[model samples]
Target: MSYDDLMAMRPGVTFDARGEAQVLVWAPKAEKLQLQFGEEAKMLDMEPKDYGFWTLQTRALWPGDRYRFLLDGKGPYPDPATLYQPEGVHGPSEAFDLQEYEWSDRNWKNPSMKDYIIYELHTGTFTEEGTFAAVEAKLDHLVELGVNAIELMPVSQFAGDRNWGYDGVFPYSTQNSYGGPAMLQQLVDACHEKGIAVILDMVYNHLGPEGNTLGHFGHYFTDKYHTPWGDAINFDDAWSDAVRHYFVQNALMWFRDFHIDALRLDAVHAIKDFSPVHILQEIRQQVDALVRETGREHYLIVEMDLNDTRFVKPIEAGGYGMHAQWVDEFHHALRVSSGQERNGYYVDFDGVASLGKSFRDAYVFDGLYSDHRKRKFGIKADGIPGQQFIVFSQNHDHIGNRMLGERTSQLVSFEMQKLLAGTVFVSPFVPLLFMGEEWAEPNPFQYFVSHTEEELAEAVRKGRKSEFAAFHLEGEAPDPMAVSTFENSKLQWALIDQPPHGTMLQYYRQWIVLRKSQQLLRECDRNGLSVEVFGEKELLCIQRVWGRQHLVAFLNFSKSSQEVSLPFEHLSWHKLMASSDSAWNGPLEMPEQAEAGALTVAAESITVYANIINS
Candidate 1:
C-alpha cells in the first residue's frame, strides 16, 4: 500500500508519484513555517491549513533527502513525526521510503494468545553486539527454547547510546544506537520467518525529559494530571484530539510500516484519560480495524499496576477490549513463597497460600484490603480467562529495580530455581521469561543509562540511589551513568555450554514442551482450576481439569522433604515430569505411577502427574 493509504494520509512528509514532495506539519505556535532541504539549505514556505496543519509541495525533496522545519524564522528542528532519526534525537531527521525494504514473511500469521510464551529482552543488553542484527543471530536459541513470541523492551530513540528504553523521546523513530529503523524491520522479518511474533514495548504515559521538543511545537502534555515521570499526556483536555492522534498514528505505523505483530504498552495505569472513549479503547478499535484490513492477527497488551479486568474486558461490556495485561501479583506471590527477602510490596502477600491463590484466581489483591496502599485494592476478575493475564517469575522490573539487581538464580538455590520455573510454566496464565533466565545467566540486569548532558546524568544517579533507600540495602547502588554498569548487564551466552546452565536449559525446554502438549495444561479456563495449600507443611497442590482430562502438580516449598496425601485418591495417575527427576540431573527418581496414596516430595521440588485415562 502507498504511504498515504497506509498512514491514513496523515500530516507528515510524503512524496507524490510526480516526483514532488508534500510536507505537512502541525505547528500552530509558528506564524511562519519553512522547510530546509538538502546540503544547499533550500528553504520553502508552507501554506497554513486547517487545524494548525501546514502543507507545501516542492521538488526539493526526494526519497533519501534530509529536511528540518523552521518555525517563524527560528532555528531548524526535526519533524515531530520523523520515521528515521539516523543521528541522535537532537540531530536532523532523514526522509526514507518504507517500501524500499522487502519482506519475506508476507503470509506470516501470529500465534494464538494461548500459545504465547513471551521472552522479554532488551536489545542493548541481550547480546554482545547490542543491535537488532545481533538479536536476529539468537533467534535460533529462542526457537529451541520453544517460546512463540519475543516481547522486546522499548526500542524507541532515547537521548544517548544506552538506556532501559523507557526514556524514549521520539516514539516513531527506532533507536539509532540499536541500528535504527531498517535494522528493526529486518529483526521483525526474521522473527516472523521463524514462526515467532514480535511484541514491541512502548512508553506513552510520559516522554523523556531530555531531547523532548513536543511542548515547543504544541500542547502534547498537560500539567493538570501529574505522572511519576513528569506531566501526563493531554488526552482529555482542550485541543487533545491532535495529541491523541499523534500517539494513535504511532501505534498504527508500527504495525503497518514495521510489521510488528503485537504492542505491549508500558504502564497504562499512569495514563490518566477520562474521555468519553478512553485512549486505550481508541487504540484497540483502530488496531482492530487494521487487523481486518491487513488480514493479520495483532495483539495489544498493557502493563497496568491496578488489577482491573476492565482493561482486558470487551468494549461491549464497558471495558478497554485489550488482549492481556502484565499481572504482578503472581510474581509477588511466587517471590514471597520462595523465601525471598520481604520488603516494600512483598510484605503484602502471604507465603504458600498466596501463591496458590494467585494460581487459582489471577489476582491475590482482588477487592481485598492492601496493607501497602492502606486501601481496598483491585476489582474482582471473576469471568476473565487465565490467558488474559501474563505472569512471570522474573522480569526486567522485578530484577533490575532491586538495589543490587539480583536474579532469582542469585537469590535462591538451584533446586528452588527449578521449582520456580515449573510453577510459572505449568500455570494456566501466559508465561514470560527474561532474556537470560532459561540458562540462569549470572549477570544482573541492572538499570543503566548513558546521557550526554552532565546535569541530567547526575540527576538520574541520585534518583536511583534514593529510590532504593527504602529497601535499606547494603553497599552502594551502582552508578547508572557508568559504562561498566551497562557492560556488566550483558548476557554471557557461552555459559549455556557449561554444566548447570546446560541442565537448566534442558529443564526449561521440557516444561515448555509439556505445557504445549498436554490438553489440560494448555487450557485457559480460569474456573476449571483448583488450588489446595497445606500452610503448615509448606506444600501447595494445583489441580487443573478440563472435562475428564486431569493434570495435577505438587509443589513443596520447604527446605526439607515432606510427605503429602494425594487429594485425588480415586484416580490412577502417571508421572509426566518432576523437578527432582534424574533427567534434570537431580538426585531423586520419579515414580512411574502413583496409586492413590501418600507421596514424598523432595525439598524445594515440583512434580506433575496426569490421569492415566484421557477424556
Candidate 2:
C-alpha cells in the first residue's frame, strides 16, 4: 500500500462523533489479536484487515478507561501509540481526551523565529516540584527575563520517576511522573496565555531499550543499520512506510493536540534513511500544511552534530527545509576562549580567533578540516540568516555529560560569567540560555536516570565513565541511578534574590531589553555583520549594521585591562551597555566614550557602542 493509504489506517485509538471509539493494532506476525479493557472487562476479538491491521469498534471505550492489546492470545502489552501511561511503562495505557480541556489561548499567536530568545530548561530540574504545573508557576520569571519562547528537554515516558527523557520508550505518552497528558496540555495553554511559545524536544532516531514492544507489533525496526542507542528505526526497509507514518503522526500530535509551537528534533544525524524522500523533508511538508490550516506559525528545530546547512536550507534548494538547528561551534569557541578545560572536542577549537570567526560566519568549521574528527566537516552557512542557527554558551549536553557536572559559572569568575552573557546576547544568532545560567545558579546539571532493570543501570554507569576517560577527566563520574544526583541538579530558585546573583540577573534582564530595543542588534543577515580579532591583546571588535544604525561591541578576554581602538574612530558613538559597569559590581571604570584614541576595557569585560549615522 502507498504511504498515504497506510497513514489513513490510523493504527491507534480513534473516537467518532457519536462517541464510539475504535481500537486498532498493527501486528503482521500475529494471526489473532484481541483488545482487553480494564482488569475484569471482557476481551473482544479484533477483526483482521488488510496490511497487517486489526480493528475493533465499540461504544464501551471511553475517556480514562485503561486497556491493553492481547497479541496472538498469549499475553497483553501496552499500546505502542499510547496517549497516557499512568501506571508506568509496563502497565496498561490510559485513554485520554484532548477535547476536554478548556483552553484560554484562542487568540494567542506564536512569535516569529527571528524574534526568538529561547530559554532551554529540563522540566524535572527546572523547579523544586519537577512537574508541569510547577513549570507553569515559573513562567512569570521567564516573561520578566524577556524570553519569548521556552524549549523543554524531552518529556516522553521513560523507565522510572527521574530521567533525561531521551530514553523514552513510548513516543506519544506524556510522562506519568510529570502529571501526565492533561498537565502537559495545561502547561502549553498557560504559556500561550503569557505570550510565550513552547518547544518540545523529540527523539525519533531510536527508542529506549526498556519497555519497547514495537518490534513485536510489526517491522518497526531494521537490522540494516545500528544506532548508538539500539537498532535503527525502519524508515527505508521492508514495511517501513508504516513505521514512518507512526513517527510522523507523533510529531503532528504534539502540535495538533498539545498546542506545541515547535519541535526540537534530537540528533537528526543518527536518523538513517536511504529513501527517495527523506523523513525530515516529509515532516517539514506536513508541518507547513498544518500551519496553513491553523493559521499559526510552527517550526522544526534540529539538534545535529554535523554542521551541515542542508537541514535548514529551503526545499527547492535540494534541502530538508527545517526552520533552525543548534550550533555547537559557538558554545565550544566561547568555552575554550574563557579559559575552560580543553579536552575531547575542545582540542579542535582555537580560542578567541575561532570565536571571532563564529561571530562573523556563524560556523567556525564551515567546510574546514577538524583535528578531532580527522576529517573535514560542515558546509558554508554564508547566506543563511542568523535566526536559523541557535547558539548558547552552556546547554544540557555540555554540562550534564561532564564527569562532575560543573557549569560555566564554576569554571570561571563572576566577571567572566557576565562577559559570557554579553557575548551570547549580543550575537546575531538566536541565543538560548540554560535554566540557571542567568543568575549563575550553583547547582550542577548532572546526568540522572531511574532505570528499573539492574543490569541496564550498571551498563549506563560503565558507559559514562569510559566515555569521559577519552576526555582525560579524572575522578569518578556521578552515579546515574542515584536520587541525590537528580536532586543536586535542581535549580535553587531562591538564589535569584541573593547578592551577586541578583546583580547578574538584573544584568541579563538589561541585556535582553537592549537586544529587543536595538534594530542593528537584532539583524540576522550575516552580510550585515563583521568581526575583527586582536589575538595578541586578547580582544575582539564585532560590528553589526542595519540601515543607518550601527552597533559595535568590544570584548576583552584577557586577565588584565587592555586599551583597544574603537571600530569607528571618526563617528560619534554612544555607550549602549557594558558588562564592567559598577552597577553590576565589576572592577572596571565605565567611560562615556573613547579616552584619547582608544577605549580602556577592564579585564574580561564587554562594552557595546551605537552610532546612527545615515550614510
RMSD for each of the candidates: 2.2, 1.4
lDDT of 2 by residue, 136-188 (tens): 99999999999999999999889899999999999999999889999999999
Q: How well is each residue in 290-379 modelled by candidate 1, as lDDT tens digits?
A: 998999888999998998988999999999999999989999999988999789888899989889888888899999999988999998
* Index of the highest-lDDT prediction: 2
Candidate 1: 10-residue stretch with minimal lDDT: 1-10
lDDT values of the candidates? 0.87, 0.88
Q: Can you list the residue pairs that collide in candidate 2?
A: none
What is candidate 2's local distance difference test score? 0.88
Model 2 misplacement above 4 A: 1-6, 593-596
After superposing all C-alphas onto the true structure, candidate 2 shows an RMSD in angstroms of: 1.4
Residue 404 lDDT, candidate 2, scale 0-100: 88
TM-scores for every candidate against the unseen true structure: 0.97, 0.98
Quote model 2's TM-score.
0.98
lDDT of 1 at 318: 97
